[model samples]
Target: MSEPLLSADAWTDRLFSDGWVKPSGGVIAVQEPATETVLTQVGRADRSDVARAAASAKAAQPAWAALTADARQAILLRAADLLVEHAPDLAPWIMRESGSVAAKAAVELEHAAGFVRQAGAMATEAAGLVLPSSPGKTSIARRVPLGVVAVISPFNFPLVLSIRAVAPALATGNAVVLKPDPRTPISGGFLIARVFEAAGLPAGLLHVLPGDAEAGDALCRDPNIAMVAFTGSTGAGRKVGEVAGAHLKKVALELGGKNPLIILDDADPDVAASNAAWGAWLHQGQVCMTAGRLLVQRGIHDAVVERLAAKAGHLPVGDPMRGDVALGPLISRGQLDRVHAIVSDTVADGARLVAGGTHKGLCYAPTVLTGVAPGMRAFEEEIFGPIAAVTVFDDLDEAARLANDGPYGLSAGIISGSVGRAMTLGAKLEVGHLHINDQTVDAGPHSPFGGMKASGNGTRISGPANLDEFTTWRWETVKAAATAYPF
Candidate 1:
């Protein structure tokens, strides 16, 4: 059966900064993953276009920052309201471009909108405290916007990931020039620009440039852009950091992860297996916080693996628009082939495929593997697919060791019958976010989400911390009378 079409109004190629602009360089044909059809065409912005966007943001920053905090807050709140009003139109674009199922797509829409509202609240809390100073003098510190920001986002979870930076930047009075991944312009960044524009954001405060990596490089190198706020792979983030660092520009990075999920011996095998399925198979495991490593205590390893394999085989996989399907096609053929290649290589190196290591086009079957050890590519790398590798651990120490052995330390999950034991073990794990009696893949607009070590650049992205990422603090002192002076 032919899948239903996405909303008609969103199918266009125009770009927006101060206003809608026609494409001058090239065009990018966005393909629908489920049907392999050309869903829409977006502008492929070049270096010159990026420079123009940066300049526009620079020009708009001061006026935006000077506005009353309540005014800026109202605009962002209106943008949030607009998102909910238009979710039906926007959700389809998310599904068509990012290959997200309806449920996940709805979550993305609501998360994006909720983030904007939360950011508005953060704006009211951006004030600093007064400190003690010399006699007859008062000292104070105040938080201020960091001028223009360049936001580079990824394709998976396009709406929330992109909005995660943009909404915070704007709420803190910083203008932003967003360069979304070419594969997901409409769903990722363009809708955000439209909502803010309708909500009466000043011209040039929020710009959406749909293009490739070259455009992102241009934004990073531009002097007018005060900082770079990025969400993507660690490999690409390293390059962005290098450029921004060389120019002495501030940067906030939310990068990759190799998350671990541990199932204690006392836990129910069926319940643990079901949670594992949800963590590893949602959106075909494309999430940065997906549970890539499964560590099970020896007593329940065999039984849990059996149940997990059975769950993998039972999940419905097909078009994302289908109500019954649990798994959807990957974003593109390139991703599909990359995931297949990793699975093939790991299976060749003694990793036993307990259930599935197969694919029919972009829909790779939910797979479960056992005996995955150190040094194997699948064990060491981020597969970014619906594949879970299990490792048997003899004790809590062994489980913690296996979990923290990997380079990435984004998130981890512990499943135990005892809450005290789970909390004890959770403290030992070297991850930024820990879930007690839950799966690893989780996030919320009000939560301060990021990672430790290589997972992020020592900066927070959501909640009140988001305001700190996009703004700087300045100290001031006022003397009531002239005391002794050095000059």
Candidate 2:
């Protein structure tokens, strides 16, 4: 008989602290969202376990910081190489655990490797600045690592989300205690540990804990942790920020988005619809930057809606691990129910269900609704599912207003034949990322990524911004000798 892909023999079922060990909180069964089958059981960490992990991280951080920059860079670079080398094994684990299609899983693996490599390259960059000072003295402002960082990542795109923070934090010389969502512990937590372990990271410098809200809350409040980096929903991010703030800890949040995609009158209906369809339904619309609202100018509204609806209906939906499909399934039954409720509620509120509004088990058909107004549930809420609610606007003024109406300001896109017009309209929207002539669902390894308003705090992540996220500024002054003071 063949062994399981992530067998206990090949991977530890225990959480990593000082070492891989059993947790006081027993174990949680990690399920495959598409089939609703148990993929494996992983150790769950409790408050006590979080305490131990935080202590381990705090103790080991100084040594990690003390290492030469080249030493740290080498480990991160090797981890990136290892991730690419292990993609065959790792991609399947991500697909089975996260219900991502083969293509999406592949993209996640590639992006994660890029993020690690970017961090490795950043490690050797200048870490401080020299400034003008009074005569006979020198002033230097240096970027120093936060003592220990706690990372809370979500289940969707688990590998990419977790590593984006983990690699940069480690590269900046901070120890990390990562709490991945319980649903995707293997890809989010275990896979990271394995790669860094193989890269020869020092023991106690990195810990992976798969736990529930209690464990996460405990991690935020732990005294030893100096910062918290979180990627999840807005409600959860608010709680994390509040708790972490109370402890005077620096927090970096990449939260939810009800992102908008605007189609101008001059845009080609087919091309605009394609961009909207890809943005809204990609990965079953589980991405944080998924286009939740599609605002089309009145001149092209009907054409765009018709094309988008047709595209949504034709896209395949099934178990991705078994065969080729555009989308797999929602993360769980609860998520599926929430998505359906929003769709049903929106449809009932007089929005026309143009394409789909049905589900079988956890797989929801890509859905589209037209005549969706601002007050509708689908228009206001972040329906993190395969549903696209589109509304019409008479002019660019109304379009910008509609796009900016929602509480979220994560990502927005403007599709127009006139690039200047799109740029003019996009500049007015209160979003962190505004793409001209493209979709909102785009990111680069070196691009600064985050959200605004309810989507996230003002802080950013990735690229050169990581130095700011994982480190603090320290100022020092040197003098030829102690200045003599007169009383």
Global CA lDDT of candidate 2, please?
0.91
Which prediction has the highest TM-score against the true structure? 2
lDDT of 2 by residue, 1-487 (tens): 1222345544346787776788999889888989999888889999999999999899999999999999999999999988888888889989999999999999999999999999999999999999999899999999999999999999999999999999999999999999999999989988999889888999999999999999999988999999999999999999999999999999888899999999999999999999999999999999999999999999999999989888987888999988999989899999999999999899899999999898877999999999999899999999889988999999989998999997899999999999999988988999999999888899868999998999899999999789889899999999989978997
| Runs off by more than 4 Å, candidate 1 | 1-11, 480-486
The CA root-mean-square deviation of candidate 1, after full C-alpha superposition on the true structure, stands at: 2.9
Q: List the residue pairs that clash in candidate 1.
A: none
lDDT of each: 0.87, 0.91
Instruction: Report how far off residue 304 is in candidate 2 (Å).
Output: 1.3
